[model samples]
Target: MSEFQKVVLSREITGVPVAQDFAIEAMARPEIAEGELLVKNAFLSLDPYIGSRLKGRHMSGPAPKIGELIPGLAVGEVLESRAAGFAPGDHVVGESGWRTHCVMDAAAAQKVDAAIQPLSLHLGVCGMPGLTAWASAHHLAKVREGDRVLVSSATGPVGGTVGQLARIKGATKVVGLAGSDTKCRTVEREYGFDLCINYKDADWTDQLAAALPDGITVYHDNVGGDVLDAALANLADYGRVILCGLISQYNLPEGERPAGPNPGVYILKRAQLSGLVVYDYMAEQADYAARAFEWIESGDLRYVEDRAEGLAATPELFAKLMHGDNVGKTVVALGNG
Candidate 1:
């Protein structure tokens, strides 16, 4: 009870993360201040965003210092609370980082229903990823009936949710572009995407053209660089593009970044481009979670997750993710809660 463990950055990540870049250490359990809650994390979400955060390439905030805890989203139970509107034993989701225990500001947390089976879902479909999909659906894109929607990185939690929601909204076709063949199959069979293309294939763009003969009406882009460029080339007359994440070059240091997709393509396609910053929609999270919860319960919306055990497993899990090898949302079980 007197000590806890944390995964820290052992060295600066110059490119994609590797297992050696992280090290876990034990530290003294600390007291919580007023307006803070002490939490015991049961599951940690290892997302692609963490890869950019580790390299200080993301816009979220300053990066963690060397030997500091790496950034992560966690679902856990409250061990003690000094904040209003919260009590001990309540389940909460927050930026608890990669740790067995943490004392975080109450304002950073969203209380989740304990009845929701598998607390890890709070970190995946029902948590930030779900909220991202909802916000993009309601505030950004207009998913018209019979429209063709193409989603990049489609097998992951956010992409799968986005594509499925588009499907529910009456989009005639929901296509996905993933890194591997197995992922493509999973998206088509499990997530209900109309078609899933493995972009790793040399003729993938040709396949996308053949699959959607009319061109894509909406492009929900996650990976950038060439993927964005290619998607733009096949865009319909008036496509709406959502720029979510640019994981393609997220790891590159400042000067090494590419020039990115062409502006002419957007102009030629009359593409309506809107960038998605999830924090902008934070105030409406509860309401959206309620709706997403229902869709999940009713089987209208679906998700997949890949889980690993223990905090020590995070580095390896995350490394695999950055290498584009993991299927679905990747989570690490702490086995503490």
Candidate 2:
């Protein structure tokens, strides 16, 4: 292709994102240098963390600047390659951002077997979000059989996957906290969680307490603000809290972000709280992918995608995601199969 479209950060978002915050511009295809591969991105992921990046703050490295391509993960096909192991037609997954095409070095792109799962799955359940769920549930939380697990933002990809994996690992009960009653039903009926509470309801905290009468043993926190505070209040003695994404606070001004769970709760309950960053487990990606695929194939795990067609739709999709409008993993489809 002679030209392609990319989404660039147009302005800093002080609150919720809107179309004015992003610009879709046409650009000449990048020239591939030796040892680099040119990839045609098929699907770009829309995640809550991207919201924090848009505001020039993140837990990771430097934040994306205005006029920069919005940072994201995508699954694509190699169209041209001077890289040693990559070849034309190879499917790969990488940090390609919100663009139709990008040039990536060999070390940055990892080949994926489309035959094992759909290419878009690489950007969701089988990709970074999936790995984040795995690392949080297995490593940080150390979820065990008979544990009473509670997950916040339970309708999103990471929380949904964590709940399912916890159940598969033999957790006696897995409860979820979602934004709406519909989402709560979907989390319980479709994702197989034992129970789900609608956090939007006025009595949701009471509902949470009723759901976890024995207290929560494992808390997979995704929307870490008021929900996290509620989890802390109900934490069992020696309970484990896996700190995942803090979506509820991502779009807020720094000073307006809610005070997080009380530190005194940790001391009084003798609880353990650990932060999780999926990239820290890069060395175990292959193992995580294998096991995720196995669970998916065996009907033990189910995943959903809220997909938008075309690269231009990403900005709106991302805004909706930040406002809790998506039901599962959100992805933008950019290429034909």
Superposition-based RMSD of candidate 2 using all C-alpha atoms, in angstroms: 1.7
List, residue by residue over 30-139, the lDDT tens digit for candidate 1. 59999999999999999888777776677766789989988888889999999999899998988888988888789989898877767887888778887888766656
Model 1 scores a C-alpha lDDT of 0.86
What are the models' TM-scores? 0.96, 0.95
The lowest-lDDT stretch of 10 consecutive residues in candidate 2 is: 254-263
Tell me the spans in candidate 2 whose CA falls farther than 4 Å from its real position: 1-3, 254-258
lDDT of each: 0.86, 0.86
In the range 136-213, model 2's lDDT, one tens digit per residue, is: 888888888889999998888888999999998889999999989888888988899999999889999998899999
Model 2 lDDT, residue 135, Cα: 93
lDDT computed for candidate 2: 0.86
Clash statistics: count for each candidate = 0, 0
